[model samples]
Every structure is written in C-alpha cells, then in structure tokens.
Target: MAQMNMIEAIRSALDVKLSQDPDVLIFGEDVGYFGGVFRCTAGLQEKHGLHRVFDTPIAEGGIVGAAVGMAAFGLRPCIEIQFADYIYPGYDQICSEAARMRYRSAGEFTSPLTIRTPVGGGIHGGQTHSQSPEALFTHIAGIKTIIPSNPYDAKGLLIKAIEDNDPVLFLEPKRLYNGPFEGDPNIPAVSWAGHELGEVPEGHYTIDFEKARLHTQGSALTIICYGTMVWVAEAAAKAAGIEADILDLRSLMPLDLDSIIKSVKKTGRCMVLHEATRTSGFGAELIAEIQEHCFYALEAPIVRVTGWDTPYPHALEWEYFPGKARVTKAITKMMEG
Candidate 1:
C-alpha cells in the first residue's frame, strides 16, 4: 500500500474503473486538457484517451442531462460538477430524471450515473466555492449521497458508487483533499503522507455501502458525523480529554442505523456534527433518528455542533465553522449533563 491524498486516491479509483470497465467514462469542465481545475483528472485524458476521459461544456444541466441519457443506454458515466456549489443548475436532471428512472420505469430502466463534486470550505473559497449542500441531495427521494473522510475510504467508496446501478452523489470534502483537518484553521492540517488513512491499495477495492466507520471506542460520548467533521470530532474529543466514540457515515441515504443505535445506547450521550448549516442540515436528520431509536437510553439532550444558520462567512470563516473550540465546548456540556 502507498500513501495517497484524496485527489490521488480518487484518480486511482477512476483509472482502475476506466481500465476494468469499458462502459465507464469521465467528463466534466476542465477535466480534459487541464485535467480538472484541481487536477484530479490530470493525465487521465492521455491515459484513457479523449473519448473515455474528456471534457464537457460549462452547462451543468446539459452535462447531467447527457449523463442521464448515457446511463440509460448502458454506460456508466462518472460526471464531475467541479464544485458542489455549482451543481444546482443540474439539480433537475439529477433529482427529476436520474433519481426517478428506476421508479418511473417500474424497474425497467436504471440510471447508474455517478456525480462527483468537491464540497465544504477550507481554502477561503468564500460563499460560492465553499458551501456544503449535501443535505439538499440527501433529502431527495431517490439517489444515494456519499462522503468519505479519508483517502482509503475515498478510493474504495468511489469505486462502489461508480459501479452501482443507481444515482450516486459523491461529495468530496475539499477541506480534506490534501490533508486531514483537525477543526482548527490556525494549526496547519497535517498531510496524509504518513497517516494510516492515507495508505490506499493499488488495485480495485470497494467498501460496503451504508456502513459507518468507527473511529474510537468510548462510553463517555458518541460523536456521529461524516466527511471532514469526522476528523474534527476526533480532534475535539482529544482536546477535551474525553474518550469519544466517533462514527463516520460513508453514505447518507442508506444510513447505518444499526451502528448508530448501538453507539448511542452504549454511550447514552450523542452529538451530531457537520459543516453544513444548522437548520435542515444532515445533523438534524441524525438527531431525529437518534431521538426515535435511542430515546430511552439518552442521559442528556442530544447536542448538535454545526455551522450557523447563515451563508458561509468570507471574513469570519473560522467563526462560522464549528471548530475545535465549539465542538470541545459541546463535548464538555454533553459530559456534564
């Protein structure tokens, strides 16, 4: 196994899929000649040829619409939206067409399209570049929403999403692209060069869907989160000097309720964390589920440490982000109760 950042891991997954399955193709703006704005698709166009790994027009709607059409015709089109914030133009194609293909056709047709986009804030991308709209897609009736917290999981889960015969929204946390963020903007995030999670396999590997990755075992508290928040929660727990059991939800639609319930029951304290805004965020759904399943086991009110219910702040990003100070305070409060 070799150490790989999230970008390298994702590229490896795409490379393996393109080589193994001729039906698989990748296309998006700047993904061809420029190899994507983030260079995730660099060298892919030359390696797989223009037809297999090419670039698309700037029209997001047309991009997604074409993907839907290609998927129906027995091709696995792994399309990228460049940024999650720019995916709204293609929302109709994703929710209305690809998501409902199987249901509308009574299982006669299935839209196996994989939509990948970079999400979350870390590089001062401001409001436009750094919005976590994952909660929006998770609310849709059809389609699966996935967010992997590390390079290893990113490679495996991406491969799974690309192969599945359904609409899959793969939200890549931009904050964790090159390193693991520990909920602090002041401290530089360490690179994944020597980290265990950065060690990815060379060949094809698919992690099971709807499974939660448990970080640590502890009875003090259970911290449930996904994407970049998973690392932040662990850091918060360490800073607070409280042993916390953290669960990284790799997929949102097909949630791992069994793991959640077990953890909450054992800890008797739960907290949902996310970079998305507070109102109507994915944390709300997690809290609702925890309330329903572990109502009796709760010793304290389920705490939620999330971003404020406002647009991502450009000047005060750290204040808006639920950083270590915020998460640690929540942990302390939860423990006190």
Candidate 2:
C-alpha cells in the first residue's frame, strides 16, 4: 500500500466524490487557482473543471450563505473557510439557516453542505489562524461536527460529511497536514482502531458518522479524545508505560456514547483531554455522561487535562494545548488515587 500525506488523502476523497456525483462541487477562497491555503484542493480545479471546483470571494459569510443556497437547490456544496477562527463570521448562517433548514421545514428542505476549515495550533499560525471551534458548532442543535486525526479518517470523514443530508462542520487539524502522514492510501480505507467507519469502499469509502474508533485496550484507564489529541494520548501512554485505552471520537455531535460507556466499564477509570478550553468543553459533557452511566465502575474521579480557560494564547500556546506530559500526569494521578 502506498503512503500519502493527510492533505493528499483528503484531496483524493474529494476528487472521488466530485467525479462520481455531478451535484458535488467545491468553492472557497483560493480553492481554484491556489488549491486552498494548505493545498488540500490542489489539482482539483484542473481535474474537475472550474465550474465544479472554483474559487470564491474573501467572505466567510458569503461562502457559507452560498453553500446553504446551493444545498437548498439540490447541490452538495463544500465551502472552505480559510481558517477555523474566521468561521465565526459565518456561524449565524451555519447555526440558524444551514443547521435548521431540515428541522425547521419538517423535512421539506435540507442543507447538505460541508464546511471545511483548517484548525489547531503548533504551526505558529497565531490566535487568528488556529482555533478549535468545533465545540461551538457541536452545541448547536442541527449541525454535525467532525475532526479527523490522520490521513485515513480525514479522507473518510470529509467524504461522509459531504454526502450527509445535514450541514456538517469538517474541522481539519492543520498540525496533522504535514509530516510522515502515516496513513496508507491502498490499505483498504479501513477504519483505524478508534475511528468511525464511514460508508466508503476500498475503491472509495465514507466512514459512518456516529461510530467511535477504539485504538487500544487496557483495564487501567480510558483516555477519550479526538482530533490531534488522540495521537498525543497514545504517545503519552507509551511514554508513561501505561496501557491506556484510547478512543478517537470521530464525530462530536452524534457522539458514540456506546463506545464511551463500554470503555469506561472495562477500564473503570477515565480521563478526557482536548485542545479546547476546559470550561464548558466537550470533556465536561463526557464526564457527566460517565458519571451517570459508569459511576460505580470508577476507581477514581474522572480527570480532565484540557486547555486552560483563557483565550488560546500566542506565546503560551504550547502550554495551552494538552500534551503528553499533562496526559501522563493525569493518568498517574488517577493511578495513585
């Protein structure tokens, strides 16, 4: 099997979908000529032609609004906001219009739109360029949010997001775009150990939206996370010599609680980590659910190693983001308790 970087894998997925469906189209700033800021859409315009894969103005709201309209008109439009931080400008469109179209219209209408944007820190893109805004989108009633950790999930989830009838927020981690990109392009598009399986095939695949990927097994502790944190948690487990069970929550809104409960029951101890701020983050919700369903199995209080409740800082960005050291510390603390 040949290896491809995360960016290439995403491009491959989009290429496959657009080729198979005439209704599938991509539009965003610099998406056509420059192939997007990260080049995730590189060569797409050339292959699919400008009408299907074209560029748009430098307006996030306009991009999202256009997508909503196109989706209402029976086209599957994928809009790329240059950065996750900029998505807020279009949040109203996503939450009010795109998200509620189907529910508001009682199935008479739908918004099959996908909003793709690069997120996270570690590349020094600064506060404006790096932000994990999925928590906000996930809180909304109508949209589905997904964050992928590697090349394989990135491709599968993006494809699934595009095809789904609801408006989907596809948060791509910019940090994972570069480097070794360990995913195998020819490896049958199988779901990773802790990844959700989309409806994609070996020739072309789309992972299901609601499943959780279990990466490892252990009776000690269950480390629950998504996006880049999954990889970090695994590394921390290895470094601490702890057999931590890891769960990659591929989809945020339609969370796979079955996976969470099952893991907690086995490990009897749980720790949640994420790049988002500690207060009112996804970890809090998971902790509440675990307390409700798996309280008796708890050997210790559920520890959360998350970003501090502050604006994602510039200089202290590394500290703000949860790392292996913090993860190990949390696990050790749980073990001690």
Judging by lDDT against the true structure, name the best candidate. Answer: 1
Q: Per-residue lDDT for 10 in model 2?
A: 82
Single out the weakest 10-residue window by summed lDDT for candidate 1: 328-337
lDDT of each: 0.92, 0.82
State residue 295's C-alpha deviation in candidate 2, in Å. Answer: 0.9
**Residue range 1-337, candidate 2, lDDT tens digits:** 3356677778888888998899999999999978988999999999989999999888888999999999999999988898999988798899999999999899888999999999877666667876887778878999999988777788888888988988999988877775421122222333233333222243477789888888777778899988878877887787668897899998988999999999999999899988878888888888999999999998889999887887777887667777767777777777888
lDDT (10s digit) by residue, model 1, range 1-337: 9889999999999999999999999999999878998878889989999999988889999999999999999999999999998999999999999999999999888899999999998778888998999889989988999999999999999999999999999999998999999878889668999999999999999998989999877889999999999989998999899998899988888899999999999999999999999999998999999999999999999999888898888998989888888999889877877
For each candidate, how many residue pairs have backbone atoms clashing (under 3 Å)? 0, 14
lDDT of 2 at 108: 86
| CA displacement after TM-score superposition, residue 325 of candidate 1 (Å) | 1.1
Clash tally for model 1: 0
Mark the 10 consecutive residues where model 2 has the least summed lDDT: 180-189
lDDT of 2 at 227: 81
Give candidate 2's TM-score: 0.92
TM-score for all models, in order of appearance: 0.99, 0.92
